[model samples]
Target: MNSPVALFQELVQAGPPADAAVHFDTACVLGGSIAGLLAARVLSDRARRVVIIEPDDLPVDPGPRTGVPQDRQVHTLLPAGHQWLERWVPGITKDAQDRGASLVGPDQALTAVNGVPLAADGEDHHLLAIGRPLLETLIRQHITSIPNVSVLKARASGLQYRDDEVSAVRYVTTTRADGDEQVLQADFVVDAMGRSSRLSHWLGDAGYDVPRLERLEAPINYASARFDRPETTAELKISGVLELFTPDYPSHGVSVAAANAIEGQQWLVMLMGYGDNRPGRTMEEFRSACAQLPEIFAEVTAGAVRGGVVTYHQAESRRRHFSGLSRFPARLVSMGDAVASFNPVYGQGMSSAALHASCLAAYLGSDADLDQAAHAFFDLQQVVVDAAWAISAGGDTARLDAESGAQVPEDIRQQRWAMNQITAATVLDADIARAFNYVTFMLRHPATLADPDLLARAVTVNEAARVTR
Candidate 1:
């Protein structure tokens, strides 16, 4: 088995070797979300025909869709995700910029954790803060434009199997009677239906052993509101700002606050809270929350409000370990939230989905057995899922502790203490910040933080800072 760090490095590479020949005939991707769209893009290269089944009538122009409730929120495409988008669809960042998305380098983005701002590490880490709607639209357009790819507006009902392998998809079209079902022949099928995906139940209903579902209860409530940007503030150096508060570092009642200069000359601001300390939906309450955050948040919110505050709540973070299953259907795989859905506050949904697409590309590009389970694809995807899960669930687990007033487990206390020290050291040390950012950006694995020398240095730096204070 490949080490997690090595696997992550391989997955992050620009593209699956370009010489991999087409091997699939027909591929069906359910759900037209980022995951499904990216999957279609990857399959388009390997399959003779690829069909994306999305229930919503995707708009020609960039706008919010009913399928994605959190579309209006400030969506930041981390450097890793930006790289994958460009790798799959060349010049996609430029395409988004042309459509009014904002791209910012390290100099133009501000990141502070627990009231301590990280010093610039002199590294070139650029991110695109394209609101989710616009980013999804661009990917949808690019994928649908492919000669071999087409989209169907329908709801997938179930899967059809032959010789223990998925062979077709049964779906109901919006134009037909609600109970009427039609079957589409497919050599391969992908489930990208998101966190609410029913692929597990479908498998169990068909007598296949379903992978264990893991859940970490995270009672998180978040609200996002848009504000008009002032023309005079064009001189402002920063286009994006993020302040994160952990259980170790509580900021009033707020968990996180982020502001981004999005398209339409507006500043999109989001405030998040946990448990009982929920953000209010009213504009006044939203502004009050912003006032509690960094001064940048207040300055941005000083302008006219663009729309009402949009609020969303997530109950838990979930993951299905398909790789752990002993038996599974062939020619069928699940991606995106169907496999794992982490806390949205980490902004890992879309980026993780993009990485999953990379795994699919690598799996299909290889000459593999189609009559058996897709363990190779599941293994590659597990690394991507676990990387995101650790960052997201780790923080939420701490919050759960705070909520219950429970003590940290004795076995994990040392690890937690080490991480806390590292987090504190990020503000004082530039190199540590770069390493930390690399992991958080999903470009590297979390194991990189376990370097003994790095941990020792973090402790020493934090001790010195405390002595100085």
Candidate 2:
């Protein structure tokens, strides 16, 4: 060991060696969204410099941005994501909540599934809901606190590599000082570029067989509009919602009272559908979707000032088999939408991405084994994501919709039994609801429902109901 001054001398004389070797001292993270930011934070801690390349000039305040379409829609940080935020960057939630973000206490935002009411003490958990822009802006504020981090207004073009090692992150930027082409040379580069990422193509061109992406696209349409908060205790709607998404009715919708959720004030409304039954972005079409609902949702929405409907259309859940890649570079990784993007109807993106961040931290913390770490990280991700897909998609397959082609005989039987069990259980059992919370919050897997006590009760309920009806 040497003193700080002597260490510098020894390092220079001995070619700057360390107890542990370093691949690169800097990383260029592509994309500046939630996942991109999370990946950048991790890279910042390990590298000497971190640059976040975001094509869209993001908002400096708590408002909508042109880049992220879903910003205006309802978004909430799941408890799992919240936990990671507390760990990765303290006071993030506190700072946002201090503004106008409303906190939905553990059990206050009650849910009724398949007609069963869930009861809870609401003691140990809480999920704070804030507008997407506010949440990201608050986080971006935290990012500025880190000296090594800087955001570049640029559009990433491609990746350049030398012998499988990424050399520079190629990009085109007009907003920087003189508006010229630029290259961010670094030891590592991360693709947090989200759903429209071109990372795979860039990697393919470098002679690496990119991951085989698994896509289960079924067209889904969403229309969302923001309204001023309602102003009346009598007119106020406190809880969120859940609806039909089965073979008989292949889609469901939800409405949330988001930031500035005060009595007699404005709130945001989002109406969505699966397959060909998707919702429309037009104010007229949006009203029609709401009218289809029983009451309150559309009625209240109709009376409020409506922001023009915004639409998001995508029909598949895609996951790249990156861990299965035979050849990959060290210090290179993909997280969030770059790796996989789930059907947002499930609201698992942020939570699952947080789980993925822990994977990133864990991978970096352990001994240097990039490939092993990648495989292990994604393997864990597969469990969480696949479980959610099964619950959401399997439920979709049960709906009797025009576009949801008939299921195979075996699949039919399985869907029937599974749907009956889950729907009935969710509506009736608090424990089942808790199990669902576990899955939703990323604290446990869906198979956690297989617990003896919970599963036995569910089976008993299923069998007794079958006998009675």
Candidate 3:
């Protein structure tokens, strides 16, 4: 059997199957969010029929739904995520851009980590900055356009098992007064139900042990609002991000300015806080929070027209240890936030989901046994989860000593310090900035920051900054 990495490479190169060749009879995906949509698209290539079970009536236009509370929040697709999405759904980025999404290169954006401005010379990665709702809507449209994929408006209640393998999904339609229940039989089932997933309970009901959960308590809050972009600020061109996270100041915030999907000149500004420092609900309070942020945010919102304020709170980042389970049911797999959810501040959730979709596609494309494929998929998915978990949870650990428990090892602490120093030195050296940007954009692993040559340059730059100060 080809290794997961080798299979993924082959899958990416070969692209989707030439025709709708059926490898499975039926595949059902629980949840119609980005993760499920992506999974359905991949499953459509292998299954004769694909069904996505979602609770809410999906929007025809880019609009908010009660199911996705964070739909209104600012979302940026890392370069790696954008690449996978483009590969899976060809011309997706172009479709989004045609609808008002902006493709921003590294040089085009104003970015400041801690308080130092990142040097702009060596940034080659470009990001898609669009509203989350619009992105999801576009993906849903694409997935439903596939010949074999269909979405049902129903809530997934449980899984029906024949012995150890899941055979069908039990669901109840939301439209009925009595809530009539239905069963959809499938050869494969995927849980893409986000953080609110009940896969553990369903597994336990099927006589399987529930996976243990690993959590990092970050306790973050966000207050955001859209605003009319000042015509004078057009010269800034790219979006602006101001992130301040340090050991001394555990209370950190981020401000992002991006073009709205409907209105090109309008932008959304989000203000976030860590721990007990929450952003205000009123427009004045939101602006006050922005004022306390870096100078760039304050200037952007100084005379800008305000929109309605929205607030969200996240208590922890969680990962289900599904890969560690000794015995797992066959024909069942979990993806997206159902398996792992990260702190939203890091913007890793959607991108990580895209990577998981890629892994699923690789596994389905191979000739691996169905039962063994579950294990292989979990193992490969963990690789994606760990990379994102380390960045999000490790970042929280670096800011608050109280949150930095045994889960954060000593080596990770040292690595975080090295990365912080490198970020600080980016203000002086553009090469260091470019290397750091690569890690941030998920194009490369965090281990790249510790390269001997890069570390040496970081040390020299830090020493020069120290002398200048």
Candidate with maximal lDDT: 1
lDDT of 1 by residue, 271-320 (tens): 88887777758999988877777678788888898978998888889999
Rank order (by TM-score, best first): 1, 3, 2
User: Stretches of candidate 2 above 4 Å error?
Assistant: 1-24, 114-116, 119-123, 176-180, 234-239, 243-265, 291-303, 370-376, 397-416, 462-469
Task: Let me know the TM-score candidate 1 reaches against the reference structure.
Answer: 0.97
Could you list the CA RMSD of all candidates, in the order they appear?
A: 1.4, 8.3, 3.1
lDDT of 3 by residue, 196-284 (tens): 89999878777687889888888877777777666687566656454654545433344332232223555777777777767767898
Which model, 1 or 3, shows the larger TM-score? Answer: 1
Give per-residue CA lDDT, model 2, range 1-100, as digits (tens): 3332232222112211123233347778888888888777766677788899898877676677766777776676776777777677778877876876
Name the lDDT of candidate 2.
0.64
Deviation of model 1 at 398, angstroms: 2.5
Each candidate: what lDDT?
A: 0.87, 0.64, 0.77
lDDT of 3: 0.77
Evaluated at residue 127, the lDDT of candidate 3 is 78
